[model samples]
Target: MTYLCLGLSICVSIPTYISFMYIRTLRLNTRFIIVRNIVLSVCLRDLMFLFTDFVTSLASKPSYLCEVTGALLQYMSTCAFLWMLCASTDIWLKVHFPYFNHANNIYFYRSLSYISPMFIVCATIGGFRSGYVDENSCWLSITSQSMWVFYSTAIVLIVLISIELAMVACKTTQALKNSVQPANIASTKDPKQSRNMAKSFLPLLAVFGITWILGIFLVIGGTIIFDLLFVIVNGLQGFVLFLSQFLFSKQVHNAWTESKERATTRTL
Candidate 1:
């Protein structure tokens, strides 16, 4: 079952990673920059999972390899969630302060997403040392006291993202009800634009948020059912994100269409 889950995850993640790379090169939006980083982080995390959880066990490697792989997996996974938080915060900031220089702040977001995880992993390793890796697998042992450091940080991030999304939803609802054009609302005169902005972020929040929420439960002594569900749902996260943000995105579709047409014109 573990092999099945990891296989499915890697299969989906590779294509999703490729699609994101293509879109990132062409889109050139501040939002896509955050999203691209998120996807890349997830892909790397999945790869680390393959090595630490699967390959290391089969190879019967030494404990230090497990420690290193565990640390890398922890770092990359934390980076993925932190990037998700950044995305949520970006939406919240855009909704509340429409004219804010988000592009300029992209550097700050990137730094936070990458560096914060390093600190968490470092603290865990520094404090626990040998406790960072499970003897049986190249991962933080759920039974270990040091594991809380990692899980707690993930929970806090999940909570923060949920709060930001809720606030954005409320603000958008209020704007639509009042029928007033706030700077934070859409730049266009349309009243529904605020609602649209809120709606657009829902799928992303749902996918990452719900998957990790289930993960938290599984870690906290969930049953076999919870374990299975987490494996299947979490494995599909990249594919879901691809469907919502890339494959079905009108912006992506239009961009591709325009690029093809431009190529045809150049050919002519």
Candidate 2:
């Protein structure tokens, strides 16, 4: 069940992320770049997870394979969450302080997405050499100390996502209140665009929240129910991300529609 869902998620998300890559407008936008990177990271992480699981099942004692896969798993999964943090932070700043220039710091945001996770994963691996395939799974087995690092990261992300969601809610309410004004009526951009923009993060938050919460619970105790929950939620992570990008995002949606039309015309 776990592999099945993760496989399906990868199948859907990779093409969706690739579609964004080809869309000039989405490719150029700083916020969308963050989102695309997030999708890319999640897809990579899920693919790695599936591959490692398959390899582990086939070779009982694949020497040093566990360490490599575990390190990569840690790095990629951490990157996914951190990139999501960057996206939320970027979006919140854009919404709250509309004039602030994010374009100048796109490099900075991109650096965080890659660098921080590499540093943490390297430190963890070097300090303890901490990755081995257990009887049932191939991952960084959670010791008391290592578990802290993992869960702590998730906790911080959850807090940041929560704060971003609250800010978005407040902004959406204010936008709605002002949307009734005559001056707002005269604005060039659709007022609904702002509301839609604010609501976009809701699905993101829901996906991150549900997946990580299941992870945290699994750490606390594992039963059949929690195992099932973890598999389904974690497996859905990539697909949820793809849906958030392709379905909810207006720019991506428009670009995708245009791409399909172009393809259809060429086929004729």
| Model 2 regions more than 4 Å off | 60-63, 130-136, 179-192, 257-268
lDDT by residue for model 1 over 168-209, one digit each (tens)?
778877777887767666644664654565566677667666
Q: Give the TM-scores of the predictions, in the order they appear.
A: 0.89, 0.85
lDDT of 2 at 204: 70
Residue ranges of candidate 1 with Cα displaced over 4 Å = 1-9, 23-26, 186-194
Give per-residue lDDT, candidate 1, residue 120: 87
User: Model 2, residue 259: what's the lDDT?
Assistant: 78
Q: At residue 61, give the lDDT of candidate 1.
A: 74
In candidate 1, position 213 carries an lDDT of 73
Ten-residue stretch with the least lDDT total in model 2 = 181-190
Residue 248, model 2: lDDT of 63
| Displacement of the residue 41 alpha carbon in candidate 2, Å | 0.6
Clashing residue pair totals per candidate (backbone < 3 A) = 0, 0
